[model samples]
Target: MQKLTIQWQRLLNDKNQTCPRCSETGETVNTGVLKLKNALAELGIEVELIQKAIDFSVFENNPLQSNSILINGKLLEDWIGGETGKSKCCDVCGDSECRTISFGENTFESIPENLIIKAGLLAAAELIEN
Candidate 1:
């Protein structure tokens, strides 16, 4: 089997508060990855998987929902099944109240579990399919 690489963009940068929602999203992706790893392991599938995370702020020019799923560098937007809302305050910031974190339109606060799972599975299968 080949190695699969999963990459995700995070909305919460180093400057902002630790967004639980974003963390939850990361956990969801990791869980799916774990599932794939274990299942493949049982089959003696020699597959190597690596998850990559990037800050959304890097794409300063484009802010048109880059938080998408990718299968071998190809954006699988359909698999990124998360509903994106307009710009909003940082609900996960501060100790007791929500704070305003200025992130451009491209930032993704959270990704739905379904998208993550689908992406994970796709990447997993891509290892064997490719």
Candidate 2:
């Protein structure tokens, strides 16, 4: 299998945390993506909403985006496989890990950077013409 490539910049400036789940937070974020996505799909939805209390805390240390990729999304499953290996346990809740989310045109798989730039230019041209 191809190794997953995840490149991301931290959302919050501060990485320090006194949260209770600091120890396993990393695991939670990683596994949560897969589980969350699957859950949403089962419900016949394309998007998954993760409230602060239900999802990861907005604690000073928490990231706006935990990983480079959002789990349960269209493109990532090819790399992450099904909900068995990487997306099973909830590193955060320690519940069964029920929630799952998907990708939109804004997502990397849908609108890659190159396409975004091209589309942006086209929109800009249309605006200028108007």
Please give each candidate's TM-score. 0.54, 0.22
On residues 3-115, what C-alpha lDDT tens digit does candidate 2 reach at each position?
11222222221333322322233344434434433443454333332322313343223332332233223223233231212122233333222222233322221113333
Kindly report which residue pairs in candidate 1 clash with one another. none
Q: List all candidate RMSDs to the true structure.
A: 7.4, 15.9
lDDT score, candidate 2: 0.30
Candidate 1 C-alpha lDDT tens digits along 1-130 = 4555556544445664345655665676667667766766765454343444434354233333334345556554443443334344344332222211122344344555555556666656656664
| Candidate 2 Cα RMSD (Å) | 15.9
